[model samples]
Structures are given as C-alpha cells and as structure tokens.
Target: MTDRSHITLYSGGHKGAESEFGQLAEQWGIQEVNFSFDGHTSIQRTRGMKVLDPEELDKGNVSMEIVSARMGRKFAHANKIRKVIQSIFHMVNNGYHVLAVGWIQPDDTVKGGTGWGVELAKLFNRPVHVYDQERNGWFTWKDNAWTAEVPELDRDTFVGTGTRNLTAEGKQAIHDFFTRAFGPA
Candidate 1:
C-alpha cells in the first residue's frame, strides 16, 4: 500500500465535498490543510486549519470583474465573496492536483468559487478532476476538454473543493475515490 501519511489534502473546509474529503483524508492517515480567514464561520474541518491573515490573503487577490467575466456570473456580494475567492487561491496554489465535486456548467466552468479553484488549476497546468453530481461521474480536464476517466492521486498534495450541498452520490464518489487511490482505510 502507498504511504498515505505523506499525502496532504488542501481544502476550504466547507460543509460539503471539502468536509468529506477531509474526513477521508483523516481516515486514510493523510495530512490535511483547510484554509480559512477571519470572520469566516462556515468551516467544518478544523484539523490542519491554517487561518490566513489579511496580507496572506491579499497574495491571492484578483479583480472581482475578472472573476465575473471568467465564470460568466455576477456576484451580488462582491466584498463578502472576495475573501472566499482569495482563500481558494491559496488552496489551489498549494496543491499540485485538484479534485472537486460540483456541477460543471456548460460554460466549461464548475459552479461557484470551486470553479475559480478549477480555473487556477487549469491555468497552472495541474491535473484537475471534477465529479459532476448531475452527470454522476468523474471528468478530468485533458487537452482543453474534460474527458471521462478514473483519476488517481499520484501527487503528494492535492486540493479538494466543491459545493456545500453534498449529495449521497457525491459522498460515495469521494469514498470510492479514496478507496481507489489508497485502498480501504
């Protein structure tokens, strides 16, 4: 078996996929880092939580207009969402592989801030995988398109982010993914 202890899961520690991923990582004896900031209160995973200061968060800052243009959606609360968008940057920047569970919009972006993380992964040319709940399958970004495939966590560090509304199927997929990568925990 692979030494899962060496693996580190970077995430936002949200209620849905990130929490599930963190739980699985703990079960598998893998390391986990859940990034957060001041005044943010929805975090579920406390282990390895690295709260970022204002300056640290600024390093990941980008114009909200650019984010809106890229995601094809407008943010009603730009100020509130800015911190989240910035925090996602640290997760994607620290991880080599990105695995997310969300709805992949027709616009080729995974919905919400999770999409921002996915976009960064693509920009960095890191391997990105998304398990679309609606599609009920995993799709990996390959050659400028999302192709169907069963992905393995070959890297020592990876980011896991997705929607807060976790589904039964989504949870199973995360479990199966961990099992496929590290065997029964």
Candidate 2:
C-alpha cells in the first residue's frame, strides 16, 4: 500500500480489467485512467480518426460556425481523452505509478494503448505491467517469446520478473502482476 494515489492504472481498460480493477480500486484505493474510442477519437492521435480543433469539442465555451460531419460523433471521445490526459498529468506531477495492462498483438508491438500506457510510464519513471490476452499471462516489452521484440521495450529492464504467468494458468494472474509491480519494496 504505497499510497497509490499517484498511480494511474493505465490499460486498455477492457471489460475484465475494468471489472476487476473497479473492485481492486475500491479495496486498494487507486487512481485509474484508460484510453478508449468507440471507433472514433483517441487520447492523443490516431490515423483515420478525425482530430478536432479543440473548439469542436467545446460547444458551451467555444462556439463553432459549422459543425463538421465528424464533430458530433467525436464529441464524447474528445471529452474522454481530455480527462484521461489530465489524470495522467495528475499522477505524474504527484509522483505515482501507472499499471498498464492491455492487448499484445502479433509482431510484438503495442497496437495502440502502448503509446499512452507504456510510453508514458517510461517517461514518468513508473512501472508498467502488460497482459497478453492471447497468451493469458503477463509479458514484458521484450522476451524472445514476444511476437515482435521492440527495441525501446527491450532497452528498459524490470526490477522483478516480467513474465509472471507464462501459461495463463489461473484467474489471479493480473492480481499477481499487481502484487509484483506495486507491492512493498
């Protein structure tokens, strides 16, 4: 219990992660943040997504002349991304960790959440934990087993074991990952 206030649980925030984290957050008192776009916006930027000019998302404050075709559909995402970035800042400024758990794709690169979750964690000197849904276990940025070993991910090393559940043996794999990632020193 290291005052996980600064820790923002950054992840895909998928259903199981969300469900489990909700309970874990309540019991452990943790601040959590996630990147989400229901086929629209992203926390920062994504290809094919319509990037707003800040005014489009701010209807009440900044009036726009003509709403773009993508404005209305992307309004909620704009707001959501704003809040998530703000939360990341809060955790970083306050000195916290961001526990990242998300989908690991083939080719061994973070498809999307990697930038928001892994990159930020590295920048802020926080620990990041990744979950491999397909493998059903914890994985690091590097390991020969990784589908595509990333150099950036490999350059950094971990204080503890990177692969906690090699086989996805049990239901408590993620829980165990938290224990190793944020547990007492």
Choose the strongest candidate by TM-score: 1
CA lDDT, every prediction? 0.93, 0.38
Q: Candidate 2: what lDDT?
A: 0.38
Q: What stretches of model 1 exceed 4 Å from their correct place?
A: none
Give per-residue CA lDDT, model 1, range 47-112, as digits (tens): 999999999999999999999988899999999999999999999999998999999999899998
Clashes of each: 0, 4
In angstroms, give how far residue 18 of model 1 lies from its true place: 0.5
Candidate 2 runs further than 4 Å off: 1-19, 28-83, 89-96, 106-109, 113-115, 142-171, 178-185
Model 2 Cα lDDT, one tens digit per residue, 1-185: 46766444433233444435434543555554433334443232121122333343332222221111212222345544553333333333333333334555554443342234444454556544456556565554433343331111222122111122233332365456545555632
lDDT of 1: 0.93
Residue 168 of candidate 2: its Cα lDDT? 36
